[model samples]
Target: MLKLDDANIEAICGQAAQLPSPSLPEVAVIGRSNVGKSSLLNAVLGKRGLLRVSQEPGRTREVIFIRVGTRGYVVDLPGYGFARVPLSVKHAWGRLVEAYLARRARGVMLLLLDIRREEPSPGDMQMVDWFRHYERRFSVVLTKADQIPRGRWKSASDGIARALGLDKDNPPFIVSVKSKEGIDSIRRLLTQGLMAE
Candidate 1:
């Protein structure tokens, strides 16, 4: 797998059903609001400010599709946890996201989690369970790893691993957008060449 020809990337749509016909492979980025999902995505695409980053949580209110290179897309899904919206809005968001997750045949999910948090939220755990039940392809990414001291990165990752029942030695991809640590590995995974593999 090689890096994407990111220069050709373009947004498909802000809504799921409105996505351009599945002309390419699709990868979805999902996590709690403010988990730095957008930041991580920018790093992966080598495009700062391409996707909207907001100080406000839940600012991303739609399913955004970005065509990457010539064969695939990087999907930016609206954040789930702690969006601070009304219950009705949240439920609506759930329905919207569910449609995409359950129906997108070429979709893979990149589940992001905050590394500094004590444990995965109940909602996050439930999503994992759902993925297992449906046999969905997904990957975990621990975001904001730079917040903790470099010496304690492993301990922090291991703690999260233990809490989430992940392999302590093979914890989720831990990364820090601020420091650009662990971004290359993710970029490789996201690159068009690797997606073909």
Candidate 2:
């Protein structure tokens, strides 16, 4: 199993040129603004306050690369949609993220969705489309699973999968940082996937 206890920041890139060279396998975490990406990272890595969590959206304006010992990296990409930032800044972020995704085609992508949201946002659908277009390895992760009743999880998962044009039988991972639900599974999945790469 891959260990994440030794994870450390490797680089913070504002532009594509500054992104670290693809020296190791990587898993990129992506979601809309304030969708609990930072919280999920902290929980999965077994570290608190490692990645800054902000009440305000769009605080993560750059690509953050974190190296996990000698194994690989867990990349934190800027969140898309529902940020209060200016239009120009949002566009810049989009371009930077596009550049990073295009360059790191070999990396795995974990696209998070808020479990409470009944439908996938436009931004979420766009990401799914992009991943499919590039034939990239990606998975959907539903955050804040604790907010909803456990009994409804299956139906919710199936609904979101259908909305995203994914196979309903293969539901997305449902996680909650507070309850520690599915965190270990995600960690193990990332470990196995990155190791195979």
lDDT of 1: 0.74
TM-score of each model, in listed order: 0.86, 0.95
Pairs of residues clashing in candidate 2: none
What tens digits encode model 1's per-residue C-alpha lDDT throughout 83-190?
457998788777767767766446567788888887889878877776666666777888998888888777777776777676445458889999899998787767
lDDT of 2: 0.86
Q: What is candidate 2's TM-score against the reference?
A: 0.95
Best by lDDT: 2
Tens digit per residue, CA lDDT, model 2, 1-197: 77788988879999878977677888889999999998899899988987999989987888998888888888888999974678998788878888877775456899999999999999999898888776778889999999999999988898899899886555699999989999999998788757855
Error of 2 at 181 (Å): 0.8
